[model samples]
Target: MTGPLHEQSVLVVGRAGGIAHAVAVAARDAGARVIAAGRHRQRLADLYAGEPDIAAEAVDLTDEGSITALASRLGSLDHVVSTASARARGRLGDLAGDAVRLSFDTKVIGPLLLAKHLSPRMRQDGSFTLFSGVAASKITVGTLAVAITNGAAEVLARSLALELAPLRVNAVSPGVIDTGAWDALGDQAKAQYFADIGARNPARRIGTPHDVANTVLFAMTSTFLTGATLPVDGGEPLT
Candidate 1:
């Protein structure tokens, strides 16, 4: 899986588990050499310890120096998928300014910086896929911060598509996916939560990490696609 990507080197930046983990495996299966990058070194290594085809690297989005160094180290890549995000939740009036800045740093500014530095080293046919969320469109009292930041990701993707030109840029917005991202809720609560959400969805089921990861694959491999946000939310927005 890790031998020269067989296709192109795919750099997936985010935590070593959950959706990022799924994406890495999907990329490797799709014949791309997969480099799983994130801020946590141990987690990154642990995520791919036995996977010879997948590599791991450490990179932080908040630090420009870190990202710049990573960009230089990568030299060239065919696809870059940033699934890194700061989990956000708070009412509009209750959130702190610093929290807002950090949210944007992770979701919006980070990807912009990636395009700024990494785009230069990307192949003409390469693409950048960002992870947005259904929250970008479905705003609630508690998801105000997440909504704004995710909305910004969509905007950033569109603008980057135009600015980056030959290198395509797009975003994938997922709904309630059973990716273990909600494992903190414990098994019973998590199951109940997903079941509740699933019942309301038109698909009558919660999404899997593969659903979103598959979308990432399309964004990078489809030569004609660009500047679009593909929703893997299964009618969450429509509902």
Candidate 2:
């Protein structure tokens, strides 16, 4: 008899990010065929170069045509994981119309389009996992776009879960994972920032990409878990 995740085909969006890489590796390790999608061709190519079990595709989530094209390539899927998000950090009033549109398009509209195109192709036992951030719950200045998008994504996941039913749909809200996205920050600033937040968190440390990845894998395999927003934030929400 096959294991729970064996022989399943999983499609992962935003495959260039650290968390997506971790999830791809974990899904592959669990005997699933992983198809990683993103807008960065070289990054996706580099990621799949050494991994025969993993495949990579270049996709722009902001374009519905691109998403539909990707769906065509996928044909059928047992799981879909979206780690895509727009990182245009700015104050509420300072954001340009295009910037706001880009942010909303990638975070909210992109996943919705993916679901619209892929839902019919997904197996009844299949599942979808979308990524949100702790900013949705935590009040942070200059993160209005992110917070709004995260909140909307979570709500969309819940609604889709209800509609999809037997096909589980969920979102993972992560906090302060040490990914390369923070490499641009000054060392002192980064250290102080994480140190302060970690101290407040009940787990007393920042989460890792693997931490979030494992939670996503759990959502994929969990037959009974649906419409749940799992916070893989090292208990930061408790603070």
Can you tell me which runs of candidate 1 are displaced by over 4 Å?
A: 1-5
RMSD of each: 1.9, 1.6
Model 1: per-residue Cα lDDT over 1-239, one tens digit each: 33334668899999878889989998998888888999997899986999866898889998889999998788689999999988667887788888888889998899889888999998998999998899988877889889989999999999999999989999999999887778899999999998888999899999998988888988888889999999999899887
TM-score of each prediction: 0.95, 0.95
Best by lDDT: 1
Worst 10 residues of 2 by lDDT: 1-10
Clashing residue pairs, candidate 1?
2-53, 5-33
Q: What value of lDDT does candidate 2 attain over all alpha carbons?
A: 0.88
User: What TM-score would you give candidate 2 relative to the actual structure?
Assistant: 0.95
